[model samples]
Target: MRRTELFFPRYAWRQPGATRGDERFRRASSLLCSLLLLLLSACSSISPKETAVSKTGESTFKSEPPKKVQAFATPERLKALDTQEAFEYRLGPGDMIGILVWRRPELSQEGILVSPDGFLTVPRIGNIQVLGLSVAEVKALVTSKLEFFYIEPEVTIRVQEFHNNKAFVLGRVSKPGVINFPGKGTLLEALALAGGIPDQNKDTSLTKCAIIRGNDTIIWIDLEDLLRNGNMALNAPVRNNDVIYIPESSDEMVYVLGEVQTPGAIQIRSGMTVLKAVMLAGGLNKNANAEKVFVVRQQTLKGDVIRVDLKKLLESGDFTQNFSLMANDIVYVSPGGMTKFNYAIEKIMPSLQMLNLGFSDLESLGVMERLRSKIWGQSGFINSSSSGATSTTTTTSP
Candidate 1:
């Protein structure tokens, strides 16, 4: 019998009819492979993102993923973005316009407010529509009209006050409300005016800022790239009524219901997994069918229900069944495998009815307070710090 060995790194193949040495090599290789597999299992079990968000069941809400403006964009796209950055301020209703005729101060007027009808009541030009017109365009119009009264009338027009041309900035910022752009508001400018995004301590890669134009277009920009990396290419021009939403961790939420100790809404943070969410909901109850856990994600009218075996994930460290949760996702653990979705909803309805009848738990109470705060501003607990102590004062919200 001849002794032969084939080897490359951890891999090995045994030739048939070989000697004892070859047999020993085969045994060693098999052990190495087993160890390698165990190592992989250990690494996967310890992975930080072991819990992770995923796909659909239910009515179809057609969701187009947010369009990301890449930080390292092409020169052509950057050029296009640059063109919108230096736009002149447009005049609109309630905007105060100042007009000067160089030497003829008598003909000029200061603090002339544009009427709600978008017309500026100039002394001689009567009411000229300057709502959507830029300052230069309005000045040109005024200058041309004054030409009738003087030779090459030198007219200088400026916006004394900005009452219009507003952008709605909502979400996690120092000031989250309607931000007024003095003139030529860009995406960056709008954010700055709203006191910029607050310091986000979570994973920056997961943080995104969106610009909603009118009712159709949504422009998504990675806040990490724009703010941390100083990516100016993502800064697009903001139009009037454009809504910029930079959601905070508290702003986004997920629902954990059915068979949980304290089933309720949980704020979604970066890397929030199903396992993590379950633990936050005070772990599962004794009656929970951990093998039949369902994640219901609904967008618009369309959605999907994904089933995972939580027992496998938590007990055996089977990472395949555990997935991350997105905003507004519902994690439902059934009491039995044959549980119906409608029946679960019916069970939840009784609790809601009880709340309506002036009966509520701590979970429901906090949720109700948050809902009231959202519907009507300043309707929740207000924290005011005094010397040597912090106090929470509650305010009634209608």
Candidate 2:
């Protein structure tokens, strides 16, 4: 019976079958791998790469993406910018006037720092009220008065102080202060006198500078265009009391710290948002908790600290939450586990060291010793490298 069963078992059971199941498994694995590779390739291909100060968050701040200025400028405005006026010297208070009468040397004299009462002291004419009169008018007045003494007094008035005509250049200039005039100076000339700008400086544009007059702030002047492009019109005539502010390039940067693939300061170019800034930081790490992206922004006047959720902004282009960043903004991404504390230590240690150095220096010299410092104490010398007392003492002792 066992021999009969053994012979019968070799029938259909021993027959070779098709490997369809094996083939199906292999095909599914291939498709999944292909899909994964395609996804990776797609990701690899995605190479991610302001004009005036506007009052409101409107189109006024919109820059026409940077193209050559030749193509970007409006023809109408270009024409309007080209007009220049003849230099007309006007007389005002504080102007040092040099009056020269051709024949009458005794009558000719120099007047400086016109009195608060707006009068200039003259020999025979006594105190002449020449404050509001033009140079030509002053000349005529002086000539008419001198005619009593002699025939046809040739009077010529040259200004020295140029008091009324001046510009105030503040903020980020090599020298941020007032630049006075009657050298018939332009905005360019004024800026040059202020040490031209620092190399590590920022400006509205290479050539663009600001001109603030009273309540009005007119911006977007191309200094380079005025110089190189032979666009004399763009070199707008500067007026008295004009405030020119050459603003630093948008300090708007996304500061990356802790566990970032490329952690550093990423500049926030135009149309850039939090998400764009993040991507520029070489995306998040494997352990990065994307949901915990916090933007620490200081509020206006109130000095309130606001935290923004960049994860939500990235998922959805919610620019409202992607608030335009300002200068000195710190963008922080909390790291996984130990990196968070590590980041804090790395950042704070330097600041603490600096503070320590400052305190140590202060402590090294006793309070009594510091107070005993003579010239610095008296002169209110806070920023001098050497104390005035040291020099004076050295001079006296020697």
Candidate 3:
């Protein structure tokens, strides 16, 4: 057999006349070679190194290592931690104390008030200086004094009323006054005694709340962090005469007025827009003319007003008309045919005036409730019927 016959068994018939089997064998061999070449080309398209690098780069970009967050104490655990601090009640001036001696009725005294000089008068024991001394230390001192008259005298000291040590809580709290405690108290306890921050004033910054002690020392308590996030590290212990001030929040706020269900102030958060502010004010009322919305910015005394087409914004998906609102901005949705800029200002002037009044004045005049009712009345704006009401509203003219 020739070389071609050995390689392609039946395809060696080209010497004289090729048989049908010779052509079929040649076609099958060509087909098999084409398939092998295609397989080789496909395998060489991507190298092993390229595949490895692609996978490595994808994993590196797609996945990130988790961040490390510090552990914080839970509320229950923080309370338990406060209990671990050993606190002893110290005797001071104006503290009513009682001295009891076992089996010595004549020597015992009740209702003994400590004088301003921090001295307590006893029947046999002369004035003893008990100032700044704990109850246990005072008991030891009294026992030592009685040792001269009797053998092994057992003395017990009790504090009937604590009046010398006090902590003051002021600003934004429900009750801003002095709080008297017998022993050492924590900042949390002082706030609780002062009735905590009022619901209306929930925007008070706990991080800014200060604990002022003496003339030089001031400690800041992060009550908000502690209460919200269980961060007890800043929960400092309050001292006598310490002033805990919970300052009102200085965060920017936007007001939504006019034809809204609940026209009031809403905090300015990130990405807040006119539409969001209107929704926060309980959405537009039934008579609200969505096409005639106005945004009044009171950055200065004169203020600037911009007209917004809220109907187009919501129905036509025109986001460009839904402007971003700034702090102290007023979003007023007016009634139909009341599109004048001055009319919108007239609607919002009363609210702006009320904001300027102090909390005390507003409380005394019952202005908050009256203002709400007046805004929601049939007129749907400031009442023009009464001359006094008109004069008062005009005084706060923009």
Which candidate leads the pack in lDDT?
1
Give per-model TM-scores. Answer: 0.49, 0.44, 0.43
Model 1 C-alpha lDDT per residue in residues 245-291, reported as the tens digit of each score? 87665667889999999999988865688998899899988778999
User: For all candidates, what are the clash counts?
Assistant: 13, 3, 0
* Candidate 3: clashing pairs of residues: none
RMSD of each: 30.5, 32.0, 32.3
Off by over 4 Å in 2: 1-84, 111-113, 147-151, 160-164, 201-208, 215-217, 220-233, 249-280, 284-398
In order, candidate lDDTs are 0.71, 0.60, 0.71
- Give the per-residue Cα lDDT of candidate 3 at 316: 87
The lowest-lDDT stretch of 10 consecutive residues in candidate 2 is 389-398
Q: Candidate 3's C-alpha lDDT? A: 0.71
Best by TM-score: 1
Ranking, lDDT, top scorer first: 1, 3, 2
Candidate 3 lDDT tens digits, 1-398: 66554444443334458766445445545554565575455446454655356644555435333322224334454454344357777778889999999999999999999999899997699899998898889999999999999999999889899977788999878889999975677777887889986776444333447777789855555555777777666577776677988766556678898999999988875457899889888998777899989999764556789999999988889989788776668899888664466566886676555444433343333333333343343212233244544322322222
How far is 278's C-alpha from truth in model 1 (Å)?
2.5
TM-score-based ranking, best first?
A: 1, 2, 3
lDDT, candidate 2, 230-300, per-residue tens: 77666565766778887565554558665467889876554455666677789888757666666655444
